[model samples]
Target: MKYFLLTTLVSLAFLTSCRTLQNTQKPSAGAAHQSQEQQYKAAVVSKAQTAQCVTAKINMDVDADGKQISCGGSLKMKRDDVIQLSLTFLGFEVGRLEFTPKDVLVVDRIHRQYSRASYAEVDFLHQAGLDFYALQSLFWNEIFTPGSRDVRSQLNRFRLAASGDYTSLLLTDAPKLNYQFLTRTSSALLDRVTVDGKTAADQGQFVWKYDNFTTLGGKLFPTSMAVSISGMGKKAGFTLALSRLNNDTDWPTRTTISSKYTQIKATSLLDKLAGMAQ
Candidate 1:
């Protein structure tokens, strides 16, 4: 169960949290006349103007196999470059999870060890077709296709379905994964994203739900997010309650891992995190 935490962190990036929007209006008659594809395209355009950089202080909770750990954390993201999540306890840093264009790095501060691996070295991530940009969309409150940096060219491949008050866009071309995004039918704000595995080896589900939206950079950004994962006869997930969000981009994108820290295999990262949390 502890090992799956690495998968959970890599797969569940940013999520929605904060104040809910109560007054978003329905589409106009002109918008109603547009095809589902066209309407979705417009929503994509509207959400594309995301923040170039974001920094937030986070209260995070991790639950796995009936064990729960809570910590103070921080989130920092620079668009197209890096996303970093740092965990602390008693005001001292305990662990760090970082994603860059080239690799994923997990630092176990308490153990003075770290693990670094290419994205391809992560099995579930490689199978799900997620990359840096796709994970960036989750953190930045935007929608995305798996392999493409931009979703515009891939619009036609998504199938839309309306159910009750929300619309779902399903990716039909994903062979190893089933990915879906749900948005409010009235305002087109993204509400949830679900990804499920299609095969036995990849038999798990990842759910990222958004709510309590507040305006950031003139956009409706989710300040709180809940992520849940269940698979392989075990369950593990985390929630990030974010505060003090800002567009601060002054920090360096890359962190230099010190030679004093001994490098460890990526597979042992979550084990170290779980032990540290206890």
Candidate 2:
């Protein structure tokens, strides 16, 4: 159970929280006979200029640490700066994660436990060079560095090459993350992201694959996603399918943790995570 919560929900950062940011979509350049580098640069710029999403509702099937769970969830932005993600099973909420600029709040319904911590308090994440925005980029199907808000600068670090139907953008010299972003050449949509990184004692790689693009709110969005993390002395993976998506501007800004739950310290959360990773 601990493994399921930490590996599937916490580590993946699939949860969303408050505030919608403006994303302006620009006209894209046609592939034509442009060089691989040019095509990649164009895609990156186009995605960056695209309008950001407001809210989403997804149906997900999660598997991690040898456990499987099926659930429904919604992603909402409050006040244009905070994002909240809530998960439900059989009409009962089982988990919620709220991400702020400086901290993260996690709730586990099954155990009546909750945890709140900043990025600095999460040693594994600091070692792996991960942050909320890095994971948030995955939710948007964009390439990003953990702490960088500038997507263009992050794209500049990668070398682009044509690989079959996809353009592969790779960052090999990065200290912690060896990253690759793959996008379909025909549609210029992000198809996959694969990155290799490690904690202090464990090395792991995560792959996120996106598929089945459908137009939502005048822009393309993937309808399905498959994410897998391997190594770390264990393997974790999940598949998320979009059930409903909207441009709704209304959503709760805070995750309500009932008084029945006990809030735990961050260290206890880390200990539990380490044991599960092993």
Candidate 3:
């Protein structure tokens, strides 16, 4: 169960190592080529322009290397501010994961241990371009370009295409990564995002899928998500089913750690995950 909590946090950042689009009639055959592209860019970007905060009770289920565990928790986030998840078992709090602009924090209450590190200090996250805003966008169900807080300004870099029943937004500008976002044409909702390594040395892909949409803060938001990563010689993922979601902004954004808890190196957290999977 401890490992499950830790893995859940890593997957949210590393696994996202991880989309938006909308519906519009196919442009006329003679229409300007970018006409359809422009419409999608507008529709997708508009979905995220208004949301700034979110809070929810989450039922988290994790499956990594064929081991599974279920836990309950709450998730809280404020755009560009913080993202936090609390884990509990048998009505007792056990662990917590928090991400802020400056660093990532993980606490294991049962073990009296914790770790904190800046984004640049985490090798896997840095190599995959999974920063605070990028991970936030993934949770908020928005398309994003690596290192940019807003994807609107970079729409020109994405190639939009409608195929069969889905609209795809593809970005190939990352040094060794390719990002693809897909929306179902029928529902016109951003449903999935995939990141694939471009070189043999960095082989593997991350797939994040959003589902179970409901209205939150007057906007359609996904209340469930499934994140899976494969290749790189290992497979892991987690699913979150959220309930009682609200756009509440009343909670504190930062957590205080006790001096008595042992501080471990951030890299050790990754090693613990690797050990758990084996």
Candidate 4:
């Protein structure tokens, strides 16, 4: 059941970078002045392109099945390299998750245990073709293709068009996963992203919604995000409201598990996370 903490932290990080949507109700972007591709590029993390790091203090609430947990945490991220997030419950540390290009390091402060896994070692992540860098892109407010880091080259795969109150970016017949991103037609700000696919352990449909925009360091940034992840047997997800963000400066680059903590196998960890441990 404690694996719940790990998954929650992991999912929360994926939901943050995409939250920079500025909530404006301008006049429907004037009938798509540019091509869909142009609109996508324009809508992505604009002023954030020059950023090498980011940090934010946020409040989170997560629900898995009928179980729910609420906590406050901080997100400290270094572009393309690592993300360090620490969760606290009433001023006490409860969990920590760090994502690097090579592995995910999780620390269960409540239980005093820790685990580490490469993308290939985590069955769900492996089957979904999700990696640390790809996750980082999503956190950085840029769209991503699992296993691909260059969003610039991958833009051609998406077909863009206006759909009612929103402009949509669609990837059909994808080799691994189908993806969709919706933006408000009025402001062209990203509203959400959808990921549909099956992992080794289950089929998954994930949606991330962005809102409550604010200006941080002179650039528009998202202050709130909601994540919904539903799989075959269960549903788990969370919502975040960021109270602070530092768009400049790097954070801790490595997650070092102490020798005092018990080391466990990656598969065993996943079983516990899925509540399949016997």
Q: lDDT winner among the candidates?
A: 3
Model 3, residue 210: displacement in angstroms?
A: 0.7
Candidate maximizing TM-score: 3
Put down candidate 1 lDDT per residue, 1-278, tens digits, no spaces: 23434434533531111011111233334545447567665685486546788898999887665667788879999988999988887898877878988988877777677888887876545655667887787777677777788787777666677779988776646655566788888878888877765544555667778888877887777888887766535566678899998889888788789999999886665454445333
lDDT of 1: 0.70
Looking at candidate 4, the ten consecutive residues that score lowest on lDDT are 16-25
For model 4, residues 1-278, the per-residue Cα lDDT tens digits are: 35458558545433321212222232234446446456555565353546677788989888766568888988888888888877888887788888888888888876778878897887777765668876776565557666677766776566566669987666554556667777677766678887764234325667878888777666666788888866535566888788878875844477666777887788766766645211
Candidate 3 differs from the real structure by a C-alpha RMSD in angstroms, to one decimal, of: 3.7
Query: Which portions of model 4 show Cα errors greater than 4 Å?
Result: 1-36, 39-49, 197-203, 248-250, 276-278
lDDT of 3 by residue, 1-278 (tens): 67767676655545534321223334345457678667777788777727678999999888776778899989999999999988888888799989898999999999899999998888778776678988888888999988998688888777776789998887776776778888877655788988876655666678889998999988899999998877746667899999999999899999889989999998897787656555
For candidate 1, the TM-score is 0.82
How many backbone overlaps does candidate 4 show?
Answer: 3
Evaluate residue 110 in candidate 3 and report its C-alpha lDDT on the 0 to 100 scale.
94
Per-residue alpha-carbon lDDT of candidate 2 for residues 9-80, written as tens digits (9 for 90 to 100): 534632211111111222234456335566557666575324444577878777766777777887775332
Model-by-model lDDT, in order? 0.70, 0.67, 0.79, 0.68
| Candidate 2 Cα outliers beyond 4 Å, as residue runs | 1-4, 10-36, 48-52, 77-80, 197-203, 258-260
| Ten-residue stretch with the least lDDT total in model 1 | 14-23
Q: What is the Cα-based TM-score of model 2? A: 0.82
Provide TM-scores for the models.
0.82, 0.82, 0.90, 0.82
